[model samples]
Target: MAQKIIGMLGGMSWKSSAEYYRLVNEGVRDRLGGLHSAQCLMWSFDFDDIAVLQREDRWNDAADLMVEAAQRLERGGADFLIICTNTMHKAYDRLRAAVDLPLLHIADPTAERIKADGHKRVGLLGTAFTMEQDFYKGRLADLHGLDVIVPDATDRATVHRIIYDELVQGKVEAASRDAYRAVIGRLVAAGAEAIILGCTEIMLLVGPEDSPVPLYDTTGLHAAAAVELALG
Candidate 1:
């Protein structure tokens, strides 16, 4: 089978983008054996610029930048597009509209995995934008019939802080990891059958070994799905 070219719009934080690249290549090697790696095209943005746009509430401008990135990937001969960051999926509609290339949404593959695991209620941990907005939870509930629970006000702030101040910058602290575990435990008590590490950086801090419930790492799930599409 000929490998399809996968286009990635990454570097919402380059740390997570690096994971996407690693997992995608590891997936290809595991499946094909013998020094195989994914054939991927990527356009990594300056996260600081995007962060500035978000802080200033210039979402349209941010969308314009993402669309430009996607279009560049398409022009570079990518068969499909994967926006590697979950938060950026906030611009999913606009990004899709701007590109002719098929986009594999991060939520779709994740919701599928959750449903397949027979989990009815899942806890989410991500940036404030992902938790507060309907772009993510709304899709899981409205489209996939899953119940989503997030941390309360206090925990939400902590999760958001840990993501940006530490994880995204490649700073993983033992204290932060412990804090995440506590938050996850609270969500479990609230009736979450599994925990969705919605932020790409969350996996760096906590994985299955560190969670009270089953941990669904969106980065790994997304990359595996990307590799499957690439190989098919």
Candidate 2:
């Protein structure tokens, strides 16, 4: 049988969507020792639509958008689908319900990595929605027992603004990077042994260097896992 094609449901900025594409292909090449890449079917939104829905908290409508993209990929012959944004995952269950393709859960796989390494306490850095909402936190605390930490209210606003306004807009200002470094420092000081880069775009702005503590790049990890599944 030919390799099963992976489908990416993207356009959660399309910037991070670019990262998913590069990493998925690179990871596949690394494992298979050639120019191999996960055969992928991808569709991207305009980002304006996704942004407005996110800002207004129209989660069901946003999920509908993703489900529509996923259905299109299915019709195009994709085997499994992954939504590239961590924030977009807020609508995971609803999207999964609307589409027939298997929706790979990024949080679970990243959480499993934390658990496998015996990291009991982890700090999370993402959009305000992912940090403050029940969807992401409940899964980390209840499902995995991996205690999750987050920045304070002021810092939360900083990270949220930086992500949506600056980073997603493709301006990776050094000041914004320093701002995130400060937040990571505080999280570690508060007893986080590792920090989860809950947003896919974050790794682009700050990598392992900005943190003294262990850093889990969820974007890289998730794409690597998707490559693994596609190759198998």
Candidate 2: lDDT over CA atoms? 0.88
Best by lDDT: 1
Off by over 4 Å in 1: none
RMSD of 2: 1.2
Indicate which candidate wins on TM-score. 1
Cα lDDT tens digits for candidate 2, 118-210: 898999999999999979888989989989989999999999999998888888999999999999999999999999999988887998889
lDDT of each: 0.93, 0.88
**Can you give the TM-score per candidate against the true fold?**
0.98, 0.96
lDDT over C-alpha atoms for residue 54 of model 2: 85
In candidate 1, position 75 carries an lDDT of 94
